[model samples]
Target: MNDMKELRILADACFSAQVGQALKRFNASHPEIQAVVSIAGAKDCLQQLKTGDVYDLAILADSGVAAAMMPDHTDGYYVFAGNSMVLAYAPGKILNAKNWREKLSDPKVSISHLEPNAHSVGYAALMACMLADSVAPGMSCTLLNHPGRKVVAADAEVTDYAFAYRTECIAKKISYASLPDTMDLSNPAFNAHYSTAKHDLTGDGKNIVQASAISHAVTIPLAAKEPEAARDFIEIFLEHNFTAQGFQPRSEIVGKSPRRIHAALEVRKPPRVQSANYEDEADVHLLQRARLLHRQQPAAEAG
Candidate 1:
């Protein structure tokens, strides 16, 4: 009875590869805990927590998710990992990225993100708001009004954690390109602009509690067979081995990294989110624009 048992893990696909490696390492080191992992989006993970059903661990894209859940739940939570938002662009857009940036000063950029209600999307929404009003104000309307942002309303899971580059650019699919994870901070690029790679706004957040400027997100959740065990998982995430294994450590990657994809880019965090009101972040405008696209099939007749 002393040994931990029946561990359920819910996490975003972003950690799919990393978590598997972590668990393999965990099992070799500690065999007492039995863990089962489910690949869920950030919003799904949140739903798992709120329903009060049954789950041992739930890893998510943004700490804001846990913060929003227990507005008072701050004490027990922790930031296990850190990531930046990637301002992905369609292939065509990247072709003339600099021009696009200039055009994006308005809504012409045609930005896309996970549903706003999802944990990751919640954060992306915050970024969208900032992008729209930051430099010249209403600049992001280029992306926002592209007709693609409308389909999939909230794609938090896709934004913050999807392991692949294309998922974030799900809307303008068939073909796309992105900047590597080590995005440039000084002069940000548009292709796949991640948050950690974005530059800071200067003298705005450094005084508060370190800069969370990067657009990408990190996952945090009050998860575990016992919340304490979940807390221990966070501790492990922050441990040296997690970083040594090439997994981005919270310290080196978190507020510490000077990741700024584009000079004009700014990072965003979520306020509070609930998956119940989740929307789709599908590429509504990707029909002929490209090959892949989102679709809502008709409910089959009661045949």
Candidate 2:
């Protein structure tokens, strides 16, 4: 008897919407292969691999992190998209300010992000701060860290601003302001500027992870149970246009000669998607939605 085929994809929260959309398209084209997606912080996703957790594929925001896994945890990978960091602020917080810098430098304004050690965006925020500190001396803003989904929630209590992916702001329709290209970690042209900002994720005096232009990549682990299925998922993911999500194409970022280490996706007619249930639809919505507010739980009060 033929065993059931399944593809499990793990991705950074920033790519949640794109991965979700790709999975849905994969399902429609190849209903026989079961595909699923899980979202986590970039570091946490890579940590799972380091701990021997085998996933069919992992799409990470940081290309450097994925490169470190090469030939050991994963055999191959490719950059599919690029993104930039933006300052997402609460309504009426920065509306009257001259620019994002002025708002961020204001003593009364507060800033927040996910924990730097666990989340890629958090580390990006730290790097942004370091870069900002260089430009505006003695800038003191109240900085906070939320260990969970608190900072990205719809009702997030960010009094002034929070660091977030540009895609998140676009997907959720949140008001945001762009930082200088160097501070945003977006343009490859500012690679030299980006190099100046760095952080030691492990809190050790070593293994410093430097800031680089944010590029998203997908890789199949060496221990992946369904490598072929993983390739099929990647094919589907590449076929989709994510411009609406504020993502730049891989070709745009890396140049015209894109790398395809594996053989090109075989062209074939796609099978019609079968009818889906409410649960299936719900899963699609959950992944496609950028906000994590729905997953948040209210804090318990003291008895």
Candidate 3:
């Protein structure tokens, strides 16, 4: 495989910039390999793997995904990053955003969650159970089911429920709430590597509760003519610095770790001393989990 080539990357849209931003700096040194990315749903990345799309790298939920591929002697799954599961609230869900604690005491908090089929969202549900056990002893928060874009807006009021990563909720500007860092569950970490590559490209997470694995699976088609070059490109992404472009840091693969990795990372560096006017960093808190978006689709009437 020639060292001079750009690898085709297929990652979840969530981490599309992770690869791009990190690679921007890497390109300065390794001018040979170019990075071409194809963004899709994490589930779709799995389908692409099974169908032989031949990508150099991919990102997916850590424990939420499972797929079968041929055992390529040269490739394997590498743990690269970890994101925690945090409870986020849609601004629309809260009846009184100003008094969130009082609102939670209300009998009608409608939390939005992806269908259980969403691997990451499913793990988040598991965390909710843990949280319930610790808080009220036996009381449980109802995990409402909704579609990716489907929502059950309050008939005359607002619902209260948010699940997913902080990055996602903030990106959409939803009303978000999170647990203290001490309660984070950092076990399930993300994994990815070329089916034939030797390393993974990830730094660490600033978010803790939903710190699940995003295993980016990249598979070479059985008939891929340039398997060697493809493998080389995967190596570049793993070892290169693509984070300068706003790629959220993944402590595991990069360098930072511990549950506070994300929290600690959030501290402004020396160069950016001033605050208040800075642009928002999506999913800035590593100690928190993400809030998954879910809403029900209106059912169609039978003709």
Better of 2 and 3 by TM-score: 2
* Model 3 lDDT, residue 70, Cα: 33
Q: What is every candidate's alpha-carbon RMSD to the true fold?
A: 16.5, 14.4, 13.9
Please report the candidate that would top lDDT against the real structure: 2
TM-score of each: 0.50, 0.74, 0.49
Give the worst 10-residue stretch by lDDT in candidate 3.
193-202
CA lDDT, every model vs. true structure: 0.38, 0.65, 0.40
Cα deviation in Å at residue 156, candidate 3? Answer: 20
Identify the leading candidate in terms of TM-score. Answer: 2
CA shift at 132, candidate 3, in angstroms? 3.1
Task: State residue 92's C-alpha deviation in candidate 2, in Å.
Answer: 1.7
